[model samples]
Target: MTPVLVALEAFHVLRPLWLGALVPIAALWWMVRARRAHRAAPRDGLAPHLRDALTVGSDGQRRVMPIDMVCVALALLAFGASGPTWSRQPDPFVAQSAPLVAALKVTPSMTADDIAPSRLERGKQKIRDLLELRAGARTALIAYAGTAHVAVPMTEDPGVMLPYLAGLDPAVMPEEGDRPGLALDSAQALLSRETGPGAVLFVTDGLDPDDVPALSAANVIILSLLPEGQGDRGLEAVSDVPVIAVTADGADVAQIDRLLDAAQARALLDDDRQPWLDRGPWLALPAALLMLLWFRRGWTMRWVLMVAAFLLTQPASQARADGIADWFFTPDQRGRLAFDRGDFRVASEAFSDPLWRGYALYRDGQYADAAEVLSRVETAQAAFIQGMAYLRSRSYRDGVRAFETALLRDPDYPNAAENLETARAIVAYVEEAQEQSDTGEDRGIGADDVVFDNESGKGEETVISVPEDGADALLSADQWMTTVDTRTGDFLKSRFALEQNRPAPSAEADAPDGDEPREDSSQSQAPELAE
Candidate 1:
């Protein structure tokens, strides 16, 4: 549904009982206004010009009074208390930037240098840039010529997708054809595995008009690698799908980012699991702003202001109890003062509100206590803070859980999903390492027992050196991935051939005479990635 319709449908107050307060406030305001208007009515004994001169103020009817401001503010507070809401909150589990399956055409035409070094090369550059723009978002890659194959699965790591993206080429494909529809379908299939909202991006030199319906049906956007005037005929048919042409700068990537954000928002708005967003509190801001007018010379409540100032100026010491300040300031008020002064430990002890107390504890370097305390406050930011505390305490599993919960509450919570992924990865790595090292040999952090990991190039050179043909010089998986022991062209060729030669399921099940099922000829190589 359109946003306007959705808002109209969802518009309702959460605490409708609070709206009753507006009635009394409105009546009082009306009565006072009528009484003032009655008193302001001109006396029949006075002349018109003389009465005009005697009038002290300009047009009482049009003038706004302090009473009006108070009534408006009270009405706003009442509406706010009623908890007015119009839209559901987005699903917190969904990533802020939606998952994307990017399909790049690997046809010979992509190698054409009409635009630059090559259309294919430029497309790769665009994908690389887009990955940077969508750093924490899950992304997959596909290559299609005569057919389509998943080069990379959904992953947050741009590192994983880049190598496979650079490997795609026309020569690697077993067959040669412009089958964008196949590529689009493959991308859609990959995206279907994900539970949250996602989009499909087709990076191609040209598209077939026949494929327009498929693209239009899905959340798909096209990045045309062809020059401005070259691919108009095919692209003109793409009336529904957004077709973004190649740009000299980063404009194409920016446009793609905007499209992705918009698609994600659209999908989130339709999600039934999302909660209603509380819009009532937003009304308080205008009310508070309007009430600022009461601080004017005559409108000021001098005694009330003085009393407030006295309370705010009280000593911030958290240890003080039953003193004059204690009678004046609440524990939270004192805690706030202490917190503002950077006495976090004092603030942590003094704070009565669980949320504020947890924040103060976190600031005081009591992470475990902070995490435990923050659990009581069920909010996205609270959960996020708690997650950080867990990570800080080396509780990876707990950290992951906290981050996930935070995302479930608010998907747009900054860096929550990314941190959750990192925590999960760390936990997995630790578990795997422990399982592999189950020999139960004792290890220590001694000079000889210092195992190195995640080492950069120059740093690795300084620690240990191995001769080229040493017996123990077996290349690790990480070493092989970075250095590329196998040729990209050879790998793609074998995989493409395996998939192409695989028999169709229907052909295998139904023999010509319907006597028996046919056996597959290409049984040696399965059409699957060798993980």
Candidate 2:
């Protein structure tokens, strides 16, 4: 049932609050003016029949025109013209949050040719679909290679996990093995201990060594995504961790059942499942049609001056809607939604907008600029983003600081806390590595550190040298000969020269034929000129 409200939103139509006050004042002023005019005018004598007819009494009857009622009706019309409208909405319903976890395998086999584009990409697509389907669920992302890394901690936003998944390169960590046990342990770490209701989905090419016991021990619902056609037949499990085996192409019944069995995850086909009746078609279509008909009839205009008032009130309406919409929706999110609906260019523009310029800078490894832009975002989600930007920028100190700030604002903020710990660990690891490198240890930053370069065609490399204190001398010497672009490297060379107390070139040589020769030079013997 819809109840009518006076719709204070109409007041928004009045440009200025004081202008509304003028309504009563104008009426009073007009009344005073009429009284004065009546006092000044002289009354002329008239015949009884003539006076009776003029008095609205041609039949010898006198009556007063309901002027007060007429004035009231006019006032009501003016107010209605102020664009009064009723907002009809259905009864409020409670929304419940679902618990969800996405476990992605970062195994080397995932890069195999069995899947088109690769098993990892296919897994990411499936996970994206699952995330979209479970909109309001608390989600987490765990990436398992030789070891497991919590790509994203458990939280409400599943979208943030998208980039970490997308940017995954097998070459980043040595041709590392995929450890399912480590992945399960990480997944279990993310779940709430009190309630084992969380669902864990494993997206892999069924190549990881079986860790069915760990999976079962963690009470994780394992939904295994296998290569197309082939199932997880040989990939036997040590424990009965119900495996929901699905084709690499898409999610299937086999996959769903396995997932459900593993974690006791919710299944739609089950009789215990409660369905949400989609009344959208029933309500939305009829409401839209009714609105169209109502607008076409134009009867609402008689009592409400909506059309006329809307033109006068649009400025305020647009402002309010924009302010609120901008706060709740990020440009990237809006653009992605549009992209999902097939508006590619529009979505791309939104994602590439200046507002999110920091993210682009961060992606390019310019951490400082990223930190600046991300810092402006005050929400927990933004803080989490800023933390990532800082971490990628190699500003672990700043990244940790940002995560700490986020924790203060939202103690249980999922991604921030996990990354905060990671950032701290990274800082400590780097310090220890630097110490080791200083002591004559020829090892690289870490035993498994990997750096990949797709653009230069250098897949990945491990830097094993403890770069000499003056390593720049060698690179700069080569750069001086124009062997490489030394734009910033030149600046570093100049700075090093300054630190060494190198003297500036002689003024005479730097004069460029613009300065005068010294008179003292004439007293000295003339030097021989080159032939």
Candidate 3:
């Protein structure tokens, strides 16, 4: 959806009743105008010269009056009170910006040097610029040639996405063809799993004519990697999707940003769970300027000054007592403001909500208090926080139990399994050390706070949990994950090959001939590179 269409669909008044005030205001203006006209009526049979002499100014009859200003100001205020809005608040659990999935074309054509370094490198740079523009927003990467695959999963950290993005190569793809249709499907699948609506960005030089159908169906925005004045003729057929031509400057990326915002606005409008965002305050600006005219000579009213004085003095008095903050913000709201500013200690002090308070406490390094507060919350995220709190406090057993609870509640909770294993290993290491120590008391450095010593010098050679070179045997599921020496191209090739070889339910029906021996599926294959 474009922003114009979204605004057209979403623009509405929250408090429609306030508009009724306009009726009386209009009537009052008309009555005042009629009364003034009657009072200013020329005397019966008066000469034109005498009438002109009686008027102090030539255009006095047409000059703006106090009633006109009052009516306009009141009308503006009434319109503002109606609470006009065209967008809503962002999802509380998600960032203000929408999630984005960038589907990049890793093909031989993208390596062409029509412009600068190459189309592929330029696309990569554009993606980097986009990441900078949309920091803290979740984004994913997809690479497509003959088939599409996720190069990187959705993540808020640009560092994680950038490494995989840089590693993508046309040679890494399992097959060779421009299959953006498949890429769109992959992008959709990734977005389908998101809690809120997201947008897909296609960074490619051109698209196959047949791919237009798939492109037309979705709200994908295309960042044309093709040089200026050059484009895929097939894309002109796409009516709904916006194709932003590549620019040397940031204009193209700015268009992509707008499309992403439109997606978020659409989500806000469609979700009944959230309320329409009130934009009533925007109307106050014009109304305020109109009221300023009342300060002129012969127009100043005692009530206006009284109201202005009261509004001004009231805030100072409220500031002294903090009553204004109390009136405008809840405790949790204040805590969230503080939390966003990195003042976790103040956030912890202000938060009455157990989860936020506990999280704030944890960030502030009050792990003991965090664990105690978080234990009252039953959610998986709360359990995860509590578990980390325990780990920080050197309560390995408690940390293990908390992690186990989190896994039981939500097995997919990120990093929960790895932390659980670490806690368990620490506990095991402590027990083993206790058994080996001759004094039967902790004496030397162990994991975290646990210590063991060989005072007797009789204990067998002790095994360390993780090596000094930074092995994750004490943490993650697979210790070899960090040790893998395989290049990203090789890793992606193997991953895509596995998917390509997997049997599909419609394999026989879709194949040209089920009885014939299977041949190579790649439309074009690059020569194998030497290791």
Which candidate tops lDDT? 3
Q: Which candidate is the best by TM-score?
A: 3
Candidate 3 residues lying further than 4 Å off, grouped into runs, are: 41-54, 302-317, 320-531
Which TM-score value belongs to model 1?
0.60
lDDT (10s digit) by residue, model 2, range 1-531 = 001122222114322343374487458546844654454322378776666556532221122223333344444444434433322221111112235567787767777656667777777777777766655346777666665555556554566667666766565433377676766655655553213255566777664445655566655555555564676643554345555555644555334433433332222112122332222233333333433433444223342355557667766533323555566577776764554443444554567554345444443456676678667767654565567666655667677788888788888765456667767777666665554444443455723353321122322233453345675534434334776544432433343234234353221121123211110111111111000
Off by over 4 Å in 2: 1-197, 200-288, 294-333, 336-369, 377-384, 403-425, 439-531
**Better by lDDT, candidate 2 or 1:** 1
Model 3 weakest lDDT span, ten residues long: 522-531
What range of 10 consecutive residues in model 2 has the weakest lDDT sum? 522-531
Q: How much lDDT does each candidate structure score?
A: 0.73, 0.49, 0.75
TM-scores of the models, in the order given: 0.60, 0.33, 0.69
Q: Which digits, one per residue and each the tens of the lDDT, describe model 3 over residues 1-531?
A: 678888988788999999999999999888877776667645678888898777664454487888888889889889989999888764333355787889999999999999788999999999999998887677888889888887776676789777778888888888999889888877887776555678889998887778888887887888888776676777777677888888899988888887888777776677676667788887778888988888789887666788888888864533322667766578888988887565789999989999889988976789999999999999887887788778777777888889899889988776677778867777776667756654544334544433443233344443334445654335433545876788877877787677677775121221122121111111111100000
lDDT at 202, model 1: 90
* Worst-scoring 10-residue span by lDDT in model 1: 518-527
lDDT-based ranking, best first? 3, 1, 2
For residue 319, what is the lDDT in candidate 3?
A: 37
Error of 2 at 276 (Å): 15
